[model samples]
Target chain A: MSDSDSPSAITWCAIIAATCLLLFLFQQILWLVVPFLLALALYYLLAPLNKKLVLSGLSPDFSAALLSGAFLLLSGAALLFIYPIAIAHASEWQIALLRYLEGGTRAIEGMIAMMQDKFVFLRDSDISNDARQNLMNFAEQFSDKHLGKVILTIAAWLPSILLAPIITYFLLKDGAQLRRFIGCTVPNAFFEKTLYLIYALDRTARLYFLGLIKVAAIDAAFLTIGLWLLGVPSALILGIISALLGWIPYIGPLMGLTLSIMVTATDFPGDMVLLYWVMGLFGVLRILDDFVFLPYIVGKSMHLHPLLTLLMFFVGEAIAGVAGLMLVIPILAMVMVLGETLEIILLDTRLRARHTYARNLHKRAVTRDLNIS
Target chain B: MLLNLTGKFQAFKGTETPQLTTMRGITLFSQVATNELRAIKGLLHRRTYIKDEIIFDEGEKGQAIYFIIDGKVLICKQGRPQDGAIAELGAGQCFGEMALIDNSPRMAQVRAAEDCTLDVLFREDFLGLIETHSRIASKLSLELARMMGERLRQTINSYVL
Candidate 1:
C-alpha cells in the first residue's frame, strides 16, 4: 500500500497467478498446510504476550519456552475437566443429535409442503416427492454411512494438530534468527528494502488474522445473546459452534443456519414459529456480517476490492475446492505484499545499478591486491 | 569435560565482537551502557562494502543510519563536480543519522573511500525501542539531538561569517 511502490497491472496479475498456484499446491499437502496455518495463527495470538516477556528482560528462547509450557498445561487442565462431563453426557448428546437430524429432515419436508401449497405446479410435479425421499434417505443412512468416515477424518487430523504448538514455539523463539538468515542472502544495495518487505508481510498477515478473530468474537457474542433471549437451551455452546462454522465464507454461514434450524426444531418440536425466528435471526446476522463486520474489519485489513474478493472465492473453489475458498484471501494478502515490494526492487533502475556497481567495486578491490602480488 | 566446557563458555561470554566494540565508540551510542548496548545489538545488522561502492545515493529515501566499523567513506553531491567531496568520514563515525528521525530523502550521496564494514540500525527498530526500552531510546535520541544541534550551529556560523 506504500505510495512509493504502487503495484502495477502486471504485478497484480502475477499476485493472482501465484496465489492460485500456491492454493493448488497447498491442497496437495493439506495436512501439513493446515497445521502450519493453525500454528501461524497461534503464534500471532501469543506473540504480544511473548514480546512483553522479552521486553521484561526475559531472553526470547526463555520466553518462548515459558509461554508454550503454560499453554500446554492450561490445555491439558481444561481437557481433564471437560472430558468427564463430556463422557457423562455422551449418550444424551448422541440421542439429541439424532433427534435434531430428524427434526431438520422434517423442517425441509414442511418447507416443501408449504411451497407446494403456494404453487400448484410444484404439487403437480415430482420435485416435492423426490426431495422428500432424498431427505428421508439421507437421515436414515447418515449414521451408518457417514459417521465412521467423519470419525476417521478427525482421528487422522489429531497428530497434525499436535504439531501446532511445536511450530508456534519455534516461531516465537527463532523468528528473528530466521529473518536475519533471509536478510543475509540479499546484497547490500537491496538489504534495507528487503527488511522492510519482511516487516510489511508480517504486519499484513498479523492484521488479517487478528481482524478475523475480532469478527468471530463479535458474531459469537451477538448469536449467544440472541439465542439466550429466544430461550434456546445451551445457547452459549450453540452460538460458539455456529460462529466457528461461519469461518468458511459462503458455505459456512449456510451450514451454521442449518445447524441452528435443526436445534431450534428439535428443542421446540411442532413450533414453526421458533424455526421461522431462527431463520430470520440468521438472515439479519448475514446482512450485518456482509455489510458491516466484514467491510470494516477483514476487508480493511486486506485492502482488496470486494469484486476481486468475490471472484477469487469462486476461482479458489474451482482450483482447490473448499481449501481454496478458505485460504484464498489470506494467500492473496501475502502475495500482494510480496509482489508489491518485489516490483519496487525490480523496477528501480537506481537500486539495480547500485547493486551492479557494488559487484564491480568488489571485483576491482579483489584484483587490486592480486595484481600487486 | 564439564570443567573445560565451562571454561570455554566463560571465555566466549567475556569476549566482544569487533563490531560491538566499534559501536560502543560511536557518539550516537556513547551514552548507552554495556547491557543496553547488548540489547540494541539485536536490532543491528552488519554488512561489508568494497572500496568506492556507493552506500546510498542523494535524493534516495533513507531508512537506516550506518556506523562505520572499519575504513572510510566519502559524502558528496551528485552533479556538483566543482564542489568535490564534502566530507570524508572514518571509523567510529556514523552517517545518515537523520534517517532515524524521519524518512525524508537523503541530502547527500555516500560512497566507501575504502573497503569497510558497517553496522546499520533501522528506523523501525529504533522506534520499537521507544515503545519497549524507553530509557535506552531516550539516551540515544538525546545524543542524536545534541549532534544535530552542533551541526546546525556550525552551518549557522558558516553562513554568518
Candidate 2:
C-alpha cells in the first residue's frame, strides 16, 4: 500500500476535499461536462462520415450542418411523439400505483400464505396497511405539489433542447481542426506516442458506447415483443422503460425484473406460466448479455473487474444514483486512459524535449566517431 | 526498420502539446477579429492530406489559406533557388495566408508530414468578402504590414548574423 506521511496525507485530503467541493458547487457545470464530452464523442463518431462528405464536395460546415439538422429533426420528431405517451403512461402508472400497491401487497400476502415457504421474492419488505395508506396519501400530496412544475420545466427547456443540434453542428465542423490543433501543440519528441494513446482511447470509447447502444436496442426488441406475446399490456412502454433503466448495470435489470413481475401480478394475478416466462426470458437475455452480447460488442475494453464494477456502480449510485451508474463506468474508462497518458507523458522523460535533444546529440556523436574511424 | 522516423514525421507517443504551438491556422479573414473567429469557425471549409502529400508546392499559384488542424505539415522553401528545405511547419501556425490578400505564387512548398487535415478559405471568395466589407481592407492591410515587418526583421537578423 502507498501509505502517506501525515503532512502529505493532509495535503492529499485538502486536494480531494477541494476537488469534491468544486464538483459539488459546480454541479450544473458537471451536467454541461457530459454534453461537451458527448459532443466530442459525437465528433469522433461522425468524423469519418464528415471527412467523406467533405471529400465528396460538401464543405465541412455544410456537412456538419446538414447531418446535425437531420439528426435533430429525427430525434426531435421521436421525442415529440414519445414524450406525451411516456408522460401519460407515467401519470397513469402513478395514479394507479396506490391500487396497484394495495393489490400487490394483498397478492403478495396471499402468495406468501399459499406458498408458505418456497417463494423468496414476496416474503420481505411488507409495508404495514396503515403505513401503506399514508404512503399513498403522501405520494398524492407530493404529486399535487410537484407534477405540474415538473412538466412545465421539461416543456420550458424546449428551446435550449433544440440548441443541442446547433452545438453538435459546430463540434463536427471544428472537430478535425480541434484534434489537429491539439496534435500541433504536442512536442516533437512525444507526439507520435501521445497520438497513439489518444487514438487508442478514442477508439475504445467509441466502441464501448456504440456496443452499449446496440445491446440496448436488441434488448428493447426482445423484451417488447416478448412482453406483447405474453399478453402483458403496455409491453412497448415497459420494454422501453426497461431498456432505459437497464443501462444502470446489475441494479437496473433487477429493478426492471421486479417491476415487470409486479405489473404482471396486477393483471394476471396468479398466472405462474407467464411470470416464469417473463423472468426466464429476461434471465436468458441477461445471460446472453453477459455471455454473448458484451463479449463481441464492448468486449474487454470496459475491462473493470466485477468487483471494481460493483464498487463503481454503488459509489456512483451513492453520488448521483442511476445517472451516475450509467456514466461512471465510461468516466472510469476515461480516467484510466487519462491516467495512463499522464504517466507516459510525465514519467517518461525519454519522450520529452531535453531527453530527445540528448538522444540526438548522442546519435550525432556516434555518427562522427564512425566517420572518424 | 523504424529508421527515418525523423524528417518531420508525426508526433511521438507520450507527448504533451505546448499551449502556444502554432498550428497551420488558415486566416482568410483579417477583418474578422479573434471574437469573430470563435463564432464563424463553424462555417469554414475543411480539407485533408496524406503523409508526404504536397499541399501546395513552392512558387505554385494557389488561392487558399490552410489551417493546421491536426497531424503535421512542413512549410519548406526551396532554400535560395532550389538548394534545400529551409523550415518545417507545425500545428497552430497559419500559412498560405498571403493569398487571401493577393493572388501570387506561393512563397514556399507546404506538404503534410503526416496524415493532415486543414480548414481552407479560398482567396477569390475572401477578396469578395473584403470588397463588401471595406473595413476588412484596413484591418488586413495593418495585419499584412505587421507580418511584413516581422519578416523584414527576421531577414535582417539572419543577414546580420
Candidate 3:
C-alpha cells in the first residue's frame, strides 16, 4: 500500500512538513525576539540584584534602567580606558611590521626560489627572472583598489557597532513585558510552557555566548601585550591577528600558533624563545577557557552534542558568513526552545483529552447504575 | 446583559458554585461562555438536592430555567426514560425554557440524580439572558425544540415500531 494510506508514516511526514512551514513563516520575527532573549538572560543573571533593589524601594523599571546603565558604563569605560593602550600597542607593532616586511621580502625571495624548484610552488612565486618588475604594479593596484575604502568603511560602521549597548539597555528595561507580549501571542494552550522554554534556552545562550566574547578579547589582549613585552618586533600586531584567528574555536588556535611561530621565527631566526613562550601562554589560556571558563559560561544551556555544535557553526558560516557564525548558536538555541515547548504542548493536549474521555465514560457508568437501581 | 448579576438563582437542593476558571482557547462557545458566565455567577445563589430530591414536580408553574452547571438532574415524565432525558441536561446545559418564556406549568418532573447544582435563572433573569445573548438563546431554542420533537416522534412511533 502507498505510504499515504499508511497511518503512522503519513502523520510523521505531515508533522515534519508543517514544522518547516511554520519556521519559514516566522523567520522575520526572529530579530525582534533575539534581543529579548538576551534581555531575559540578563534578567535572570541580574534578577537577585534587581529584587534587592526592589526591596530597597525602587520600581522594577528603575532597577532595570540602573542595571542597564551599569552594564553600559562598564563597557564604555572599558573602551575608553583600554583603547589608548591598545592603539599604542597596535602602532608600535605596525612600525615593527613594516621593518619585518622589508627584510622579510628578501627572505621570501630565497624561499620562493627554493620552493619553485623543489616545492613545486605556484607560478606567482617564481619571481627570480624579474623580481623588480612587480613591486610598483602591486603597490599601485593595492592603493587604487582596496586601501582607502577599507579605512573609510570601518569608520562608517563604527557608530552602529557602538549601538549594541543601547540595544542591551532597552532589552533590559522592557524584557519581561516583551516576553509577556510574545507569550500572549502563543495560544493559551501552550503559552506558559512555551515561555518557560524560551527563557531557559535564552539563559543558556547568554551564558555560553557572552562568556566567549570576553574570552576572545582577553586572549587577544594577552597575546598582544606579551608580544610587546617580549621585545619581539611587530609582536602586538601579530598577537592580535593570531588571537582573532584562535577565536574560531578548535582548528583556529592551531593556525594561530603556527602563524605566531612562523612570524616570530623570521624576526628572530632560531629564536625558539618567542615561539615557545607564546605557545605556552595560549595553551594555558585555552585550557582555562575550555575547562573552567566554557563550562561555567555556557554550561548546560543548550544540551547540544559537540558534533552538532560544530556542524551548526559551519552551516551558519556557509549561509551568513562571519555574522552567520556569531549568530547561529543563539538562533539554534531559540529553535530548540520553541521545538521542545511545542512538543510538550502537543503532548499535554492529548493527555487532557484522554482524561476528559475517561471522565465522560465514568459519568456514563454512573448513569447506568442509577437507572438499574 | 443576558443574565442579571444581582438577582438570586433557585438551585437544586444543596449544591453551590465551585470556584474555578475554565481552560482557555477552547473553540466551543459553551466553554468560553462558562468562564465569562462565572463572573456573574456569584450573584447566582445555588442550592443542592439529594439523589432522590424532587427538584420540581409536574404541573408546578415553571418560573425559572435551571442551569445545570454541574452534576445531572433527571427529567422523569410519569412514564418514559428517553422522553425524560430530552427535557433534562447536565453541566453547561439548561432546561424549562418553555415555561420560562411562555408562562406555562412544568410538563415533566425534575428530580436530582445526584447531589447537584442548578443555577436557576428565574423569569426575569431568563429573559435578561435571552435579551443579552439572543444568538446563543436562539441557537439553544432551536436545539431544544428539535430534541423535544424527536422524543415526541419516538414515543408516538413506539406503538407501531
Best by TM-score: 1
Candidate 3, residue A301: how far the Cα is off, in Å:
2.9
Expressed as tens digits, the lDDT of each residue in B10-72 for candidate 3 is 121112234423212111223324423332242233445445455665665455566665678
In model 3, the Cα lDDT at residue A148 comes to: 57
> Clash number for every model?
0, 27, 10
Which portions of model 2 miss their true places by more than 4 Å? A1-28, A37-52, A79-142, A145-163, A353-373, B1-161
Q: Model 2, range A258-355, lDDT digits (tens) per residue?
A: 66776787788777667778889789889988899888887877555678677766766666555566666776666555555555667665445443
Candidate lDDT values, in order: 0.82, 0.62, 0.56
lDDT of 3 by residue, A247-346 (tens): 5655678777756655665677645545568678778767877787677765756676678678767766665555455556666665555555555556
Residue A359, candidate 1: Cα error in Å is: 0.7
When 1 and 3 are scored with TM-score, the better candidate is: 1
Model 3's i-RMS, to one decimal, reads 21.1
C-alpha RMSD of candidate 1: 4.1
TM-score of 3: 0.48
Error of 2 at A8 (Å): 19
Give the true-contact fraction for every prediction, in order: 0.34, 0.00, 0.00
Worst 10 contiguous positions by lDDT, candidate 3 chain B: B5-14
Better of 2 and 3 by TM-score: 2
lDDT, candidate 3, equals: 0.56
